[model samples]
Target: MPEADSSTTPAIVLDGVSKAFGANVVLDEVSLTVRQRSIMVMLGPSGTGKSVLLRCLVGLLRPDKGRVMVFGEDVASLDAGVAKDRRQLFRIRRRFGMLFQDGALFDDMTVGENVAFPMRMHTSMSAAEIRASVDDKLRRVGLPKATSKFPSELSGGMRKRVAFARAIALEPDIVLCDEPSSGLDPVMAATLDELILELHKTLGMTFVVITHDTAEARTIADTIGLLSRGKLVTYGPTDEVLRSNHPALRQFFARSTEGPIQVL
Candidate 1:
């Protein structure tokens, strides 16, 4: 057990953000703020722009309207000219790590290579230093031995753990995860949730998780945001959001087909 930090400024903020692709509108006036070192769950059905919102938070996707501030800096305000300097890009990218769905590991790279790739690209560390960092992060994710294994050879859960290890290798202040529990069994998903909670306690990192797993969110989130049709339908503490009786909230909780959500 270690000393835990109970206070920090908001890590990420969005105000009146909206995005569209051709005829399809993704995010609609989405406004939210994630506190530092807290796990905020973004709950929404598929195609509801959860991933789009996560991308915008990291400055990966520029919104058509509104602002995205990371660590109090308006990331959306940084001009494209900022990336002209490799050092600037490296510094900016170091503040956050993103773990995408399906692990997103390169099939051709070994797990160790995948984990150390960022270090190699961004830092001037020697081989020994990179190895040590990769090993330590993999150990944190409970996958120290799987480093020699290729992504194709590892189980889905193991791949995810490796991905998590890689994401945190930089000691990023903020972590964004998209559908972390996807393709896992109930028990495995719960285990991953516990791992995430453990990391939150140990690392003191801000986490924004975009997941449709209500059960998982209930277990790990300090607050939850529910998205529907590109709009934030509900946002509050975990218990409050989950227990609410709003029609849309009820439909989400029931996971019903007759609710406000419709699939094409």
Candidate 2:
């Protein structure tokens, strides 16, 4: 990938991307673009390969075909030499921060340590700097005094907030959230959505959220990409996609059981 104007190029792009596990095709020729500094929500039913797409975007899983590009680099292109390949992968991953579903926090580490984990692993910042960063990030997430609490001590919403703090610890250009609002009550989910929007505006970083919740998608998505049965069924602005006449999309948004999307 040659150097291009950032203003014109997308922050992330997938071209003819496909992935499969033996006979099960998780993703098939799925192409999409995520604009810079915007929130792109990927909505789909369960087992529709939404998580697979996220993995491809971050280079965790290589697609069977096509290209995954982030910040103008083809992630699928790896050097033949092992060391070089590892370095390339690191560089690509360093540009992203991921908040996995269920928070994925270490059971043994305190909230502060969990947030500091990335900085410790990735940066040469001194102990004082790391502590300051942890405090700042925790405070930013509205958990100023949660440094000493263990993951087990926090509520589900608080755990998610801690994970959000950790994700932004490195201050990466893009944040990938895997079902940020999952496993929360309606009020808590809406609270998480507000935090996501607030952080996006304040930090000016791009976000890609994966979720099955249509209301959450409408809340946060500047663009919505609907996936079904290994294909991108619809991709456009939120309102446009909601208004689509596509059978599968209609079934999905309406939560109807009488359409092309069979509940099986």
Candidate 3:
């Protein structure tokens, strides 16, 4: 992978971004940039706001201060009125597709219906066109023949793959994945990782993945941002961030209890 040109606008930028829920500050003065066509993995312990940050990037959560720029538009600056904000967010969200943890499929829908859901909702494509696209995407994710299966019938990994197919059905420029490897055995996790890599390379889309798995991050991240206690402990190229001496990050990646990161 080549370094992104500094002169080019980044795919996503978060500057001095902060978020809170009631009195709890989930993110404080966090800043990071995701390069175009690159994979950025955000690593952190649970409840450290990794998912919150992802939500902010996609305009699901508005920050208290600072700005979030996606594809050069400031999402945080949208109008405060509910209708206007929603309109703006809808436009911004068109550029992104999200894969939630646990797949989040509709239990009543078949795999084919789930994969075709986005296109059905977002596009006016004919039924034939949507079916063709769903088949293509399912095949891409290695689930060609499983479309008739319901969510309940598939394994955890298969459900995840179906969710992934749904996410990319619209061909969004960016894909946000929350814990893509969670709840899987090592072999299944590895399979999912390879699929992520393959899709990234073949589709050339930017990916922002929130994960607690350091090894998965190391495998998929071109850049790594480690969050702790509502703050970004480190952010840089994967190798550079991994080489840092930051206490919180050191404890995180090394899985050690002898550092500043104490589990509650």
Candidate 4:
């Protein structure tokens, strides 16, 4: 509900971000900045810590080293209660939304209730107001009539759309999508991508998408980061990364086997 500056103050800043689970390091001294209102795609093979980085960015996971700043506040050091209070980071987080890979909808609740879940938990809206908001969100996602169905009743794509509706219910400034196109076919994937771009242009919101689909990445990302072995191997504009001669990036774009990525 807050107005994001959409300036160059970095929507998210990870300085020397690292994480280790005992002896295995998931992210190693990775540093990156996501500019406001830009679509940043984090691409890498499986197990390269893409999801880990995303969780850290959203404060779901804390890194062992360096700092994670959201809207200029250090989230890694903020206490649990303080982090959720009326602080800059909390307000900034309210400006962002997230869509998980599985849609993550509650099986017991109807689609409308699912979309209204956040509003119910966070707001003091009356029952009628919540219903109105839920209806609006469903219509926004092109699923005005799918409100009564449960998650299992809808198709995978429909469930995803419901999840998306829930994510933007609060009109977040940014949307973090983890493998948004993972379970959809080409047609459905493209439709979802179109929805993303449409929302970005219409709402003036930033997007941080994590996906390994090159086609989708090329289609949606203004900036791309190629991550490998817990590090950002390459980062730049989509065209620049595609035109680059770096072996890792080149082989990745070409779908080659002999590159920095190990096929284990």
Candidate 5:
């Protein structure tokens, strides 16, 4: 057989995925593909399954029914409790990095320490190597002089940039940002969007961002998805999906109260 082509394989594929907690369905047969080296923005209202989908991708949760494929492996089938599966899952998780909604940085550590934490934990690189890499990551996020500053010393936007630097410390193939623009003003959010675009353009990694911010989605996503009431309402090329006559899409973009999306 000819060599497998990496270009044709998507970075992520969620096929007929469903999840529930008791009677509360969080994801209902949601299916989507995230291409490599592209930014995918998932838009949804609060309580929708956007965050849960991220958890499923990282194996923090498993789907009730369906496949969650990351780089061709079905992550939904892995069980952390089993030794063999755990090993495989660990390897899979290493390919992914996440930026939490709250910019989950350690309050006690300096920015450099925070960025180097992942490398220290998972990599065999030398201390000098880690330090150099930390500086480079910080520079990439536009915080070159913040290595010595504590999280408390920085503004919310700066903190988020530090968190993003940490997320990409390992240079993972895919980075997941959960509400990256949360807790920031519109200008700061737009700055974050620019950082995302710059990083994607320079480093060439796949990005999956889950947010309710349509503006951020429009700025960063080449592919867009909308999740509501545990179902994927619309997903496709950004221009195509935005232009389509989908009620949820319209309601979301228009910021209208009357639509299929119920306010909860």
Candidate 6:
């Protein structure tokens, strides 16, 4: 079969994806499409398989059923245990840059070094080039003055900004942000949303942002998907999903506990 044009192909496709840890089901036949060069926001209450979905896309976790397609490649079919397959998986993974929930920055490394970490590990760029790129990325994140400081010397928001700078150091095709607004105050979180928007426009990378904050989703998402107990209940354009009267969707936005989504 002739392959679809790369420009038109979706960045990610999950068909009937399901994951289970023994008897507990995390993802139940969940399927969705993330169009290329778009920002997708995944919203749900705590413990709704949002984080697991990101891991599945990167091959950190495998699904028991269904296919996970990334840019026309079926990642679910590749076995990391095999030498050749592992190589292929590595190539697929190189297309991704992940921002962890806790802003996992090395405490001892200087801000510039932390941003340069991925480039040093993955690419053969010369030291001068890495240093320049690090400076540029820090400037983009509004943290140019903190280059010599350690993570311990920075505030929580500044540390996260440095981590964001590192996540884009490789210029990956897809960037996955796990709870980008998790621990910050509302102002800081909103500031990060603006940064995400700016990076998306300038970098042209597909972004899948997992966030529980409704305001964050509304502020940044081109498309929105609501996941409940591993099932995708409502998904569409950001405006459409926001207008939806579906109980689960409404309950989530209204901050209500009594609805189709039960509180444990």
In terms of lDDT, which candidate is strongest?
5
Query: lDDT per residue, candidate 5, 120-221, as tens digits?
Result: 999999999999999998887778999999999999889998999999999989999999888778887887788888878888889999888888888889
lDDT of 1: 0.82
For residues 2-87, what per-residue lDDT tens digits would candidate 3 score against the true structure? Answer: 33234367989899999999999999999888888899998888888888888888877789999999878888887647797878
Taking the tens digit of each residue's C-alpha lDDT, what string does model 1 give over 166-233?
88878788888898888778887887788788878988888889888878888899989889999999
* Model 4, runs deviating above 4 Å: 1-6, 81-92, 126-129
lDDT of each: 0.82, 0.87, 0.87, 0.84, 0.91, 0.90
- Clash totals for all models, in order? 0, 0, 0, 1, 0, 0
Between candidates 4 and 5, name the one with more favorable TM-score.
5
TM-score of each model, paired residue for residue: 0.90, 0.93, 0.92, 0.90, 0.95, 0.95
Q: Can you write out model 4's per-residue Cα lDDT over 1-264, one digit (the tens) per residue?
A: 333343656887889999988988999998888887789998888888888888787777879998987766677765546645436556556767889877899999999989999888767989999899899878877788998999999988889889999998887877999898888889888987888888888887789999978899999999999888898888888889888867877777788998777897
| Prediction RMSDs, each to the true structure | 3.7, 2.0, 3.3, 2.6, 1.8, 1.8
Q: What's the C-alpha lDDT at position 13 in model 2?
A: 89
Model 6, residue 224: displacement in angstroms? 0.3
Poorly placed runs, candidate 6 (over 4 Å): 1-5
lDDT of 5 at 71: 85
lDDT order of candidates, best first? 5, 6, 2, 3, 4, 1
- TM-score attained by model 3: 0.92
Pitting candidate 1 against candidate 6, the one with the higher TM-score is 6
Q: Distance from true position, residue 48, model 1, in Å?
A: 0.9
Q: Report how far off residue 250 is in candidate 5 (Å).
A: 0.9
Worst 10 residues of 3 by lDDT: 1-10
lDDT (Cα, 0-100) at 193 in candidate 5: 86
- What TM-score number comes out for model 1? 0.90
